[model samples]
Target: MSGSTHTVTNQPPPLVGYDVFAADRVLTEGLERHLDPGPLAETRAELTVLGRAAGSAQAREWGRLANVQPPGLRTHDPSGHRIDEVDFHPAWHRLVGKAVSAGLTAAWARPAGHLRRAAAFLVWSQVEAGHLCPVSMTHAAVPALRADPGLAALWEPRLTSTVYDFGLRPASQKAGVLLGTAMTEKQGGSDVHALTTRAEALAEDGTYTLTGHKWFCSAPMSDGFLVLAQADAGPTCFLVPRVHEDGRRNPFAIQRLKDTLGNRSNASGEVEFDGTWARRVGDEGRGVRTLAGTVAAARLDCVLGSAALMRQAVAQAVHHCTYREAFGARLVDQPLMRTVLADLAVESEAATVLALRLAAACDGAADGDERERAFLRLAVPAAKYWVTKRCTPLVAEALECLGGNGYVEESVLPRLLREAPLNSLWAGPGNVQALDVLRAVQREPGAFDAFLLEVGKARGADHRLDAAVRGLLGELGDLDAVEARARRLVERIALVLQGSLLVRYAPAEVADAFCAARLGGDGGAAFGTLPHTLGLAGIVERARPVE
Candidate 1:
């Protein structure tokens, strides 16, 4: 049948062919300010390439395919041999391989690595979030393995390699390998200390066998896992390889794979360890301490992950409004709509600046900067808590901008909305991060001081920031109901830090809008509540992604 000639008009063009890195003014500016000139130039060029690729038709199709056809878990072979393997679509492999080749896992081994990897992670995650599970685990496992020099020597090189080798094989045989972790048990999720999984000493050579079930084992198909189990000493950290030294499959039984709300491309499984052979990662009694570095790295990724989601959501919203006309004018130019978009822009930029600052802190600490180490100890938990919490609402609001289109699966916003809450829930819940912030202040006062010092750098730059900092210090001084008020306290701390960064680095219009809305209390409880006096148009324009 001949098609009817109906004109398609007024709809915004699909948001493709734009450069992800070049479009993000906040991210690009943050990189220039934070990274060394040489690394900045190199990373800028590399990310420009990645940005184009991430925005390409191929990458978008891969994202859709991976999510639509999530991974499947196969527990037995044809003859019923217990073969716990997860089968992912080719798109998943392609996305993950691209990430590995981009050095998302090799950050620790290169110069200015953390900053570059963090930026790349933010860029790539916009394409798809599920693949980041294994990517993040592989990157985080390096620091935890370093507790055992022998393990580090054996695993670090392969973990840092850019090749993506997928299979249950001996690490010795793979060109590269990925790592996962199983810390929380069924009975105790965040309270890992309540874990009941027991480890038996098989020999005096620091080898052991783990017998228990892990409630959440992310990246189940990774070559190895860093697991926590109760030992003779106490809860201990262990390295459980998928394959034994003699090349036999270890007794790692996959109970089931979780049916999650989002991040569908990744497989999170329930695994039972039936005499799983393992090597202790650190001292027998210091499991939590040994995993500190790993946890910190993962938490940083969590913040980056959330920030990436917010950035992409806002970009999509702005791009839609720029083209889609409503009520005889562009939606972006409407007064109330402009306010909403600008408010969202302010939030996205703040998150980007703060996340990059944390990455810069990681780079500094790696360089042995004592003050940065202290600052990071406090900043990570605070930023993780605030940023992840902010992501859900930001994505939801950005979704509202698209009206019905945003709610549908075809637009990608719905996936982003689903993926937004995972980061906050993954690393730890809000209370966990809040308690961590309190613990940092109580246990390491110096870290708290360093955080204050860092934020104080913009003390006189903006009176609103100065006043907010002063008020926060006053609140910190009064620790009454600290636990009860931990979330509020952490939120204030995050806002102040974000405000300080904006004051120092961002444009005056952006900084003023953020300060007025967030710090000065000129905004109400919801998005688009910024005072009409602020430069809303400028903020929105700055946030708009261009080709």
Candidate 2:
């Protein structure tokens, strides 16, 4: 006992036993405002239970185990027969099962589904983000399958089921199913039109055989995949099942699982499709159109996931600062540290408000609202670009708040940092999302107008927001260098939209700080650079997670 010169002391106790959902004032209030009172009550109760589970020691262990023990690919049987399968850690399956049981994948089939699912996804992702790969793919596949009523009729029920069936088995044998996608070839990342994978008609009944390679196939062990292949007519979408109708494995060969920077718990693979049987999802030449809704849905999930990362990162930082003191006071109460935490809180809250607003738009769109549908056309890409872009920096700064401890694997901050860049890269990259924003503005003028209409609601509420909107409108009018300035233009669009949302619903202090620092440039270039005189204490307190 006397061997060491000093004993360990002054460290804060581990952060556990807190309700993630309740601690998140922004999410809870947003859910209350967006959902009907009755549904809000019930959904809040459900999320509270989930939040407790997510923050529990057991769940934390699951997250640690999942990442430490990544998925492994099993390419063949011992007897030399090809049996392509990706095996996951038991913890991954536990997380996925919890997510499925929470109705994260059945958003389209439930009441107030999008709002519920969005909140659930945000909460669950904070626990383990890798398992969300299949969860999001399964959720997004609904719209793509709906392009063909017969296919939708056959698979929709299974996709929406709450059961988690894990294995490479026939769809008929499972109570539910998960989905994945293989859209890009090696030559084309976001440019799906450049895909060279070809599909040949196998029968007059619209079945086909695909022969090509997919450069990136996420969740390789998924029950089915929505793939893109060049057909006689043009590039088309197809549903490729893992097991054929005759109960035999499809001719799908997994080349190897990718070694990704993050998301280690999920398996992403390069696959070769040799005579892989598939059925056309929509019209032969309407692949892009058929997948439009699916992509938009997945993009929304990206926003939600990023927001979750930011929230958790900030929460961890605040929690650490609250208990760890330095010099003469708690770190959280230190003036400069308070300013930084408050600034991060502002960013996190703004992201949460915008994400939930998008979820509300999804709900409204599903209810046959034309304006909501149009708003989504512009909002999805903008939110995806901005929210995901903010995550990396936010997490990095938050990790710094914990000093060296945050950089180590023992803390979740490192994982959050690794996961941050992924969302921006997923769905599409920054340039892709920016270009998509421009495309929507030019091709779907009505959608852009709908977006402006949504933002216009809070015009007179805040002068800073009003000025930002006016500037954005002026920028939109000039299309000469639009493509060259797409990212800048998209950033303004996203900021203005987020500013508008904050002004309308956020508490006065939070909204004012966001508009000043984000819109009016009242802050420095880095995090924690908010004005000294601002209500930094109040904002930081709001973001702090308590037991």
Candidate 3:
């Protein structure tokens, strides 16, 4: 028999071998409440399959291995010729292949595509997030490419393909392809229009040769990139490919790979394009306008990514507490522990509800619903700002729930904690998002009206929500100092939206707990600070993952 000291006791079983999709009451319920998206049976079935893979022990191991052995940069071939490449572990390829084959990138032309794709992305990201950088770039590239008919005609089918074409090849030869985006340079981070990379027009047919340095290029291994560069007319967008049609290397030189804190499995490179052949994406001086759709889609992905991390962290915490024992009782049964879990659960549900609502709006907007498009103008950035900002703290609290065990590298919480801030930092940091919302509120009155109309549907549902709406309106009535208070206003806007969503869609207990704790001023600053009067155990139980 194993010795008592060596035996493992008082440990929670691994949270694996479960249907991540089916177990998520909030996600499933919100899915239905939002759009009744494309035949529920079919959509649910497909997501369930992906969910099973995400929750499997095998998939979890893939996540671990991929992170442990991050991708490597190859700047030159053995001889002397420059052949910049990024080499990823087998697990990375598998994860990317799984996501791509499941139609994660084919969301543009299908029924209820955005909602379904967003749901799938939310689930798979819990497994491994780094590889999704390329996946997201490829998916978002569809709209930017569509700005040019010839470019769209050539690249659209390849981008939306379910096949995971994993190597550099001519676009015409590949069954599928991946893409990247490079808007930020060393001198200009979010100031994309201040680019110095020059693009010289070669012929009238959208061809150009770009020459300058690109400070941050996402997914360097991608076959092509939608980059920003200065043209004769001003700043403009260009499509730069890794391999030309005649099988000649483009003059794109990889300066170095970025040493990021997390998301190490994906390669972020600083590249130099010297007389590099590219095709103009849109007319000069319109790079930002051409990239509008791409940026919006990316911001929405950040929301989903943040929400997915929160759900996984909460699931892990609840699963741990459900089995842990202290003071002669199950940890989850303890009053204080239950309160914390419930609080975390409430926050997670709010994020998921808001994210799903946004995805449904994407579907609507795709179907030519002008109202949904306008709503996205304001909601996407506000949600991105608040939800992503909340992820780091929520993950940290979830880790604390596991006590000393959580601090160790063996636990997934450490990895999750490292991954937490990435969404907030990426796709324009919190300030950028808040300021973008402020600009929208100033220039796009229709967007604000649409947002008000959406929130108005839940006007009489909850007193807290109603009061919140009133407070927001009063605050927005004056813009004399709005620039200085943009973040505060945006946070309130996101909270009210979440509150409205819960009031109309979530379970009574969840909505009540959320309104009471978040909007009703009954909670503290940290997780687990919800009022003790609520049904704590029931709320935690609803969020627990099955094994």
Clashing pairs in 1: none
What is the lDDT ranking, best to worst?
A: 1, 2, 3
Q: Can you tell me which runs of candidate 1 are displaced by over 4 Å?
A: none
Each candidate's lDDT (Cα)? Answer: 0.93, 0.92, 0.90
For each of the candidates, give the backbone clash count. 0, 1, 1
Best by lDDT: 1
- Report the lDDT tens digits of candidate 2 across residue range 372-447: 9999999999999999999999999999999999998887999989999999988899999999999999999999
- TM-scores for candidates 1 onward, in order: 0.99, 0.98, 0.98
For each candidate, C-alpha RMSD in Å? 0.9, 1.1, 1.4
lDDT at 110, model 1: 94
**What TM-score would candidate 2 get against the native?**
0.98
Candidate 2: lDDT over CA atoms?
0.92
Residue-level lDDT for 475 in candidate 1: 90
The reply for model 2, stretches above 4 Å from the true place, is 1-5
For model 3 the local lDDT of residue 230 reads 88
lDDT of 1 at 404: 95
Indicate the residue-level lDDT of 272 in model 1.
Answer: 96
